[model samples]
Target: MTVGSRRGQATESLRQLTEAVRTESSDGARLVANIADNPICRVTVDTGIPCVVLAWGSYATSAQLRFVHECALDLLRRHALHKILGDDSALAVIPVDDQGWLREDWFPRALEAGLKAAASKCPNGFFGKQSVANVMSGAPVGITVRSFEQLDEAKAWLQTVKI
Candidate 1:
């Protein structure tokens, strides 16, 4: 998963990006394409990996969850697209900020949803645990980065690991 966006841009409103995941293959490569969209999250899955680049301080609310559900469906569709792409490695990449999730209760629910989605998408239900191992192995996915600087570092760390 790689993240990139234009700098110093502000959004009109804050929204949440949440999704559900389903993997069609046990051996597939999932690459998350996290777009730098504000207000509404713009998530793209090139493979099964759903990469998301969100605004710094966007908030998640009950109304926002509906949007999350929609995103989830889109994420699943992208995973299916992975089958066509001919990549057979199952993986999930989630982006979040500690400031966004810890500051608000609503955010955690969305985060949980993302976690669940990632886990469910794993072919053997072992990808989630494997990701945890990856994290502890000096790299981590589904990690909460505090700022873009840290985000960049996290991305670098993630790049070291093969999906």
Candidate 2:
């Protein structure tokens, strides 16, 4: 695909993947924790970069965060992988309590699970960026971390990691 096409695809993919964030049911916010939408976060192994991918679909609650991270950790351990590509372009602001859970709970487990790298396409909004920063600030020391404006750029950096 052409660079422009790739960019367009990335944009459209993020939009579709995050559609759950824009609509709501009687239990709208609860979707972030359970399955109100078909998908709120997608975790999978992407062999192109030889890394696990964690793509968020909305502002996840602590429970949802746990589920996604556990999925990623399982992939990391099972495949002996150390990299993660996070698609956060449409991610909403993560709450402070959930942010703490990420740092205090998830990172340690992921590190023990053998994760060594994380790269994310950050969100455009101020609150979103701040929330990303909040979680990254508490990242464990061994894992490398980087942020990008585009998915391809993040993938390029991951390619250079020698993993």
Candidate 3:
């Protein structure tokens, strides 16, 4: 390879590494986006599900998750979204710091933002389960977050929750 091409590749590699480190930090979820239209999350308000579907093993986890929560928050503010269905089945292990941000920074605001009940199709594999459990553990008394193996079961359970 030519020297110029090698230098370019090295620069790209450094950029990727920097971004990865920056996003994986514990406080990364605090971006609080002005708008939420990212690929990592879909807000299904019209279908009457009141859900946010998250992509599994997203590389840009920090920005993606922040956007997802931001979108959910926006949906809650505009529509009074109370119930949430989680289909975050994944093969990747979430970073502890990111999980911490979810628990500390996001969950409380989400509760105040109108999240009353959540039924999750638990993320696949051990690390995913553990990460999920840790994040859900921070929920206050007013809200509920339940995990289920099957998506149908989770949805059915969510339907039972009052308002």
Candidate 4:
């Protein structure tokens, strides 16, 4: 077989593998939003919690963050979701620069979009947890953030948040 043909086959195989992984990962969740070129941030509406859920992949980029912010705001507006559950346990780290954008831009816009409360599964370590905590601290008044080690706990907390 020609070298170029071999390379084409390999690319197709890799694409199939990625699609398989994505299908398996999102098996139970209903996909609600997807941004072109930023498929890692899977936005779904959780049937169990009846809230919008942002499930992160292994890593996040600034462009992905922006996609997530915009998608979430759209979800909030369309569904009138008062609570958002961000499952960031799969995420490795929040970029230092994106942290400010999240705090100053995304968070406030979320509030204005009618999000009353949010729950995020804290990342696995002290530093990761601290990073999320720091961002949460700057959230606008009336917007509450609750951190949890488990998704169930987060969903439960979200259920109790008053609209």
Which 10 residues in a row give candidate 2 its minimum summed lDDT? 29-38
Total clashes for model 4: 0
TM-score of 1: 0.29
Q: What tens-digit string does per-residue lDDT give for candidate 1 at 9-42?
A: 1111222122211122111112112232333333
Pairs of colliding residues, candidate 2: none
Q: Candidate 1, which ten residues in sequence have the lowest lDDT sum?
A: 81-90
**Whole-model lDDT per candidate:** 0.29, 0.75, 0.65, 0.71
Pick out the ten consecutive residues of candidate 4 with the lowest summed lDDT. 28-37
Best by TM-score: 2
All candidates: TM-score:
0.29, 0.74, 0.69, 0.73
Q: Rank the candidates by lDDT, best first.
A: 2, 4, 3, 1
Using lDDT as the measure, which candidate wins? 2
Greater-TM-score candidate between 2 and 3: 2
lDDT of 2 by residue, 1-163 (tens): 7868955874574354334443444333444344423356767788988998877776665555555565577678889999999988767888888889789977987887788889999887789899888998889998888999998999899988874
Report the lDDT of model 1 for residue 10: 10
**Sorted on TM-score, highest at the top, how do the candidates line up?**
2, 4, 3, 1
